[model samples]
Target: MSGISIVGVGNMARALAARALAGGNAVEIIGRDRVKAEELAGTLDGVTVGTAGAAPAGDIVILAAPYAGAAEVVREYGDALRGRIIVDITNPVAPDLQGLVVPDDSSGAQEIAGLAPEGAHVVKAFNTVFSHVLAAGPAEGRPLDVFVAGDDAQAKARVSAFVAGMGLRPWDIGGLAMARALENVALVELGLMNHSVKHTDFSLGITLLH
Candidate 1:
């Protein structure tokens, strides 16, 4: 992708912005707190902070905010996102960071799609990997895999290519409906383990293999 705009300034967003910078992608961060966005951007090269209402126009718009906050931000940026590809990196993890609290039939990514501008396409991505790993990865010069899913095939393609640009593998898991499974509580078990276990590196599991 030509450019990326991340809509948060938290750890995940920081890591993502860093990856985009390391990969040489032009990146802008739209933070709910403008000062925080500017502060974060100051620490990173090739990135600038943006106001909540004026997210930069980019080929990729990534929602790095918490799932609980995503819908509202989508609504806030509805007009600015027309004809854009939005990538959702939020997991609906409860405050306890132990489990997901989203509805059974829906996912944060899907919810974002509902709140997005009429023509904007939303894709699920990045939540499956931990932020620290994203920043410290590529031990073997090969970034870890990144999985993406969206209702629009072209949107998925756009996001998948962006993921690939970050030195990672990108796998398309079909339409946006798959995001529910992608962000399921069960999917985070390994990530939790990765944090609890010091030596073991954990990745999200896909059970399509026999």
Candidate 2:
């Protein structure tokens, strides 16, 4: 089991914390609002709470904040995150929801990596899966597929192990550069939800034939 510190008290953070605890990993919830963080931690058994800007107790730190605030969170953590694995789960979608906020040449994860402290390994995961779907477990009887992208192979492997522990499949789709594709995939998912599916119960996955 791995030590997981999530730097947010939002839905995604709560969902990830619940799954992490279920997988026997240590979970810590940190947020700018101490009361909110404690409240979220109270809902999850065995989970701990911490304040923002504190030294995260876990080696793997997940930035579960929205795309607009993820960079600020990284900057706030600064040198404290050095040598640790930082997970970027933001999609960088525009407020209008019609396009991406990030430049076409770069992704939200890559931008966060640029702001992160030296020695910190930033991996992009969980952006494709919705918070509700993630909290509710597998969709349509198949384990959810988590697309992982990172420059560090070991970091990706560690994250994959964590995902597998939670009964999910981890797809290592090349290096951190692939995070652009993952974000685009999430954009497409959002588009489908708004226009085609008209609901949020479904998630993106790969079906294999043997």
Provide the lDDT at 23 for model 2. 97
Best by lDDT: 2
Off by over 4 Å in 2: none
The TM-scores, one per candidate, come to 0.87, 0.97
lDDT of 1: 0.80
Tens digits of per-residue lDDT for model 2, 1-210: 999999999999999999999999999999999999999999999999877888899999999999878899888889999989999999998888877888889999999999998999999999999999999998667889999999999999999999999988999998898999999999899899989999998989888987
RMSD of each: 3.0, 0.9
Off by over 4 Å in 1: 95-99, 140-143, 185-187, 190-201, 205-210
lDDT of 1 at 20: 86
Clashes of each: 0, 0
lDDT tens digits by residue: candidate 1, 79-187: 8899888898877766666556777788878878888888889899887887888887665554587888899988888788777888878889888888878776434
